[model samples]
Target: MKILNIYRSEPDATTKKLVEIVTRDRESVEFDLNVDAPDYDKLVDEIFAADKTICWW
Candidate 1:
């Protein structure tokens, strides 16, 4: 299954480990919103394409 991980902020160690465990042995894509200008357009596309989406704050 395809999993899309969206980070609202920089991930902490625990969050990182959990995401690793959840995405293990699966196709995953990561998008970070903590940048100068996040691409909402691409994020929308990814959300539509992914089978599951996880947003991390």
Candidate 2:
């Protein structure tokens, strides 16, 4: 299973620590951009193109 965590932080020590705690057991992780739109059709199409998408607001 893949986990996607989105946080609203401008890179900080605390954020790092929290991320470490949450992903400590994970052996691998990949970072990617999260795109959103007011147009549901476009947004869904983009999501379908990706393997998985987790949006945070």
Candidate 3:
């Protein structure tokens, strides 16, 4: 399964561990929105492309 992990901020230790556990042995991609500029267009494409998405705050 393809999973997309979207982070609204830098991930905490718990969040990072959870993401690691959930995405184990699966295809995963991560996108960070904490940058100066985030590409909504690419984010949209990634969302559509993945089977599941997890937003980390």
RMSD of 3: 0.6
lDDT of each: 0.97, 0.48, 0.97
- Candidate no. 3 TM-score: 0.96
Native RMSD of candidate 2 (Å)? 5.9
For each candidate, give its TM-score against the true structure. Answer: 0.96, 0.39, 0.96
Regions of candidate 1 where Cα sits further than 4 Å from its true position:
none
lDDT of 3 by residue, 1-57 (tens): 999999999999999999999999999999999999899999999999999999999
lDDT of 2 by residue, 1-57 (tens): 344444333436876676667567653243333334245565556555555454333
Write out the backbone clash pairs for model 2: none
In candidate 1 the C-alpha lDDT for residue 55 amounts to 97
How much is the lDDT of residue 34 in candidate 3? 94
